[model samples]
Target: MDLQKRFDKLKKLGLCDRCLGRQFARLGYGLQNYERGAILKESKEIHKNIFSQENIPQDISPKDDCFLCRGFFNKLDKYEKMVIAALTNYEFNNLLIGTRFPQNIKDKEKEIWEVCGDQYIEPIKTEFNRLLGKRVLKRLDVTVEFNNPDITVLVDLTKDKVELQISSVFIYGQYNKYSRNLPQTEWRYKNQYSESIQEIVQAPFVEASKAKEGKFHGAGREDIDVRCFGKREFVLELVAPKKRSIALKKLQKQVNMIQDKVEIFNLDFTVKDKKKELKGKRANKIYRALAVLSKGIEEKDFKKLKQIVGTIKQDTPQRVSHKRAKLTRKREIYKIDYDKLTSKKIDLTIKAEAGAYIKELISGDEGRTRPSVSQILGCEAKCKRLDVLDIEK
Candidate 1:
């Protein structure tokens, strides 16, 4: 509890003004540690002053060579330049500073804390980040964004290297998949090129941002074979983008012009949380499905489709059981309206709840689904082609 005893103990360890000021960080408000340490270091004549040590150890140096920081604090200019040089390739407005202390330095800091008692002392890492961030702010036109930073400058004292961690840029929009062959995300068969709606949707944004890659996050994804005619909300996450600013209309045009298979619209800048929010919203789907039947013809068959409206108890489909948990879920069919295409086939417009296995609902998935279209028709039924016509508001 004795301030003088702690000050004297820290001084005996050959700490610089910054390191010394850091020990009493809680004592002064709105003042850098080094300034406080300088005032205390220069004061003399006892009473309430920090007396200058006349006979200190020969091995222990002053500000240029301190036992605590080991001259690290004095080299802020060097680190600032290194960070700026690293930032040359990155375009970031909100940045954060991080520090990685060497093990030896950490141990030394712990020993210092033990000797002086860490009652009101700030950790070395905190001071390091603060001091370094202060240095960067003076020369650069950037602000420190703690929650969500565009980029992070990591000054690893162990390796003595400056590393930049550029954050992903998020773009919110809606997309329609015209091609049924394309998957929602990238497909890999060890080493094979597979085209997808995700790749197609992100092509222009990635090109503009000069990002390393792009990831697609949809509100709810449809099957690979199912074509989505309705606009599905999505977030395109571009990783390590050198440029955050995008020409929205131009990028949308480039994406729409790339191919007729996929079209993106209303592209706008979004935060990282938008991805989570987009995924959390569950929306029902209206599907226009082509159902092929084993038995043919009758107006009575059209009436059978009406019986399918209500709660459907469905088990996990065989196709997706490998990735999804094998569990029974209760989903619903809001409405079922059909147009008898031929005696053997019919076009069904079904409004179903979210997460309802549409294919399983039609084929009944080997009796895995109850009150299904296949069960209602009194014959074997299979969905040949499916298209999402609309998403319920």
Candidate 2:
């Protein structure tokens, strides 16, 4: 049968325009289900059965319950008010609306579609999203965002409740650590309190953004005793921020107050994807170290050090094996150069692949790594001071 015939046939069983019009949701563009249903009901194309105003059926009345939605459309005002109240405390630019209908409501939708032969019909979820989105925009003056919305309001029609989910805010920057005493994240050493790079960089941002919590993600980390001399990239993700407006310059100044330990620069707002990039990044590293040798330095030692090129197979260092699994890894050493400062002390520069253990490479780590400085030179080698000079892009 044609659309008018189908509408006339379905009208015999009670349905509201919001519910009845939804069956033909995809047939018309830029028009809501209620408008479509009202048009169909009053159209001369469909024959109407006449009953006096006093004898009209209760199911056909405008205020009657919807078979498909169970009065959900009639409760839009209540749902909208609940969502608005839930969003009053949050600051956001764009918004999205989600709904969870009861199982019986969904079953009714399926049954209706099956009886109507499922032609040009949109899902109930889509209609609810658009309807709630329009209402929220009209009231809150906020635009709808399908992707990466600042906040999402969830309406649970099953329980007659509303919930809100706030997206994380990402900020990107480069930082330098002047103190070898600080770790990249918080550290608890015995009873003494030690500072960390994460605390220094992210603590102020949490307070400034009025967020519940914050996490720092670095491109790479330096050891507690090794200083990061150059710009080290990082991202700070703030969760459920109440204050979206932030002045990065002022926050940077606040973060840099502990200049004696660490500093941050080139800071700016970034996106959530930055965290993935940092996690997947494997940039080469340049390091400078002061090495103390058991024997006096010789001219031939420099040549042997230069021979420490190509792939070096290494097992996890003993110092960190307690926390890390014992596994063998192959890492490349691009180049090795050194300058003698004393008979037993020398400055060494190394360019290597990411994750190469410089300290273990110098000490040989009790035969855990092959072709190390100590193994090649036949003496014990120890790194006294180390600094990361550069990280390749």
Candidate 3:
């Protein structure tokens, strides 16, 4: 039958174009239900004109009530303008638009589909996103990003709200924490300090690097008590950056002055593609730990540790079992050097695996860790302080 007749029946029950077109979903491509309904309405009017040899009655007004969309589909221009205004503060090359509808609207659409015996019908979300996306593309002139969009404009029609999801800015570089007692990322407290290491580190780097806010991603992390001494590989992902290129040497110098513990090295610009590749790569690390013995030990026992240096069987430490899987791993000790600082304390230098649990290796985790410094020497050895001396790629 003609859309006017169908509208007469569907309108008595109340139906939107998005709702009406959903019943005929199998027809057309790249077109929303409202657009499809509009086309169907126009075509039906044209058909009546030719057949009856007179103008068909304008029985259905364009502003007729729609059960599903509630006539909000006609408000596309207003929503598009809102999105453009929301995006003004951020810089983005690609964007994706999303829409959400109320439960009642969806329920009404479901009722219509059921009445028509589940014929081809488009979804409410599909029509909303597609129509809004098209309008945004035409008005804003921004490309759509499927995998990693610079911005995601979420149009929540259900509550009449709009939200902008901005992607983070990315920067690849190496960092060296000259001093100790700082975490690589922020440390959160339930009732205390809420800022993290990244917050402190990135603010200066953002100003120095002349980019948006930055997020720090390192190949690995050291204990909060430990300091990063040499070149530590890191990637800083900036979010909605205003500027990209900056003087790296000067920025590095500026970073050094603010926090004596943190410094950016090998500063370079990088794209999103490079960031993914660096995520899986590993780098060599050097650690210097101060070992304290329960009792004074002779130099002879220390030499014995050097003998078995190259062969160390390490497994996942028990202290980290809550967060890590239980698995046994073997790592070459590379080398071990010790300098006598006192009778009870000695400076120990060790090079091992990238993910090695260095602290547990010294304390021995109550015999769970075998061939440990305490196990090998038959002495209780504990790490008083640890420092990451170097990181090499």
Candidate 4:
């Protein structure tokens, strides 16, 4: 049918101009369906076909329900108010709008597309999204984000409910753990001596971000008895934070106050993608361990320790096998240098691949680790104190 015929046929079915205009959505540019519908209703061709000037109004109002939308476009104001009210509690600069329409609404849309061929007519969801975003920008003075929106508003038209999904605010930094008893995160078992690194770090951020909860993400973990001397990478995520703007320096300073446990530095605002990147990275780590020997070690023992280099196979340590799956992992010991402190004690500096259990590499973990310090020296050995010196990328 021609434009005039299609317009006449659609108007006769009691569809509002907004609903009628959407049927030919792609036919023009720069004007909305409401504006296009008003233009068509007042056009010379439409007016000539319908009635006289005085009898015809400037705008075409629906006499009954809209054939396509069933008066959905008319209820945009109500849905907009519901979304706006729901967003008042959150502090967001940009947002994306999502919808949950009733099954009948979707079925009606499909029916129109089947008859109209989907060439010019806009999808009901597309129209609703554009209309809602435009109104939100005008009323709330916020930007419509297509990617990485600060907040995502879901309008459930079926249940007449609104839900706000706020993205977690990430803070990236490096932490130095001074305490030996502190775990990288919370352990299932409690330690009376000290708190976990997560508990110490998250408390300050939760209060600073004004968020409901906080989680800590470390690049890799250290044992409870191991101390981190260098800056170990980490990211802290604040979930549904009301205050997104907080000084990184201030956050760093506040977190460092618990100096007895852990001190975090280089604090800055980061995104969730950084968490994935950090996790994907595998870096070599330098460790200095003070080990105790069961017997006296001669000068020849240092030469024997150097021979314990290269690819060493290690099974999961018996101490952690109950918690971790039993699997043998092959890790390289790039270099192993030692200094004599006493006949029974030696300080060993090791440069090894990531995930190479240093303590197990020293003790041999009852033969689970091959060519270890104890296996090389032909005597029993155990790591008394371990400290991570550097993490090389």
TM-score of 4: 0.90
- TM accuracy, model 2: 0.90
| Tens-digit lDDT track of model 3 for 1-393 | 553544445545545545665656565555545555555545533222222212223444445455456777778788988888887766567789888788887786677655545545567777678878988887778787888787788888877888977666666777766545556775433234344456665776577434555767877777667877766777777766644445666766776677665666777767676666766766667789898888888878778777546656666777678878788776667777888898778888988766766777788878766678888778799999888887767
Query: Can you give the lDDT of residue 49 in candidate 2?
Result: 29
Candidate models: Cα lDDT each: 0.82, 0.81, 0.68, 0.81
**Candidate order (TM-score):** 4, 2, 1, 3
For residue 381, model 3's alpha carbon misses the true position, in angstroms, by 6.0
State which candidate has the highest lDDT. 1
- Tens digits of per-residue lDDT, candidate 2, 1-393, equal 466667666676677776766777666456657655666666545433221233222344444356676777777788889999999888899998999988887887788766656676777777887788789889999899889999988999888889889998999998888887877876434234456788778888899888998888999788888998778899989999987888899989977875567888898888999998988899899999999999986887667898788999899998889988889999999988898898789899999999999998898998998989999888999999999999887
Error of 3 at 30 (Å): 9.0
TM-score of each: 0.89, 0.90, 0.67, 0.90
| Runs off by more than 4 Å, candidate 4 | 1-14, 38-67, 190-194
Q: Write the per-residue lDDT of candidate 1 for residues 314-354, one digit (tens) a residue.
A: 99999988999999999989999888888889899999999
Task: Give the higher-lDDT candidate: 1 or 3.
Answer: 1
Taking the tens digit of each residue's C-alpha lDDT, what string does model 4 give over 266-302?
Answer: 8888989999988987989999999999999899866
The residue-level lDDT of candidate 2 at 174 comes to 88
**Ranking 1 against 2 by lDDT, winner:** 1
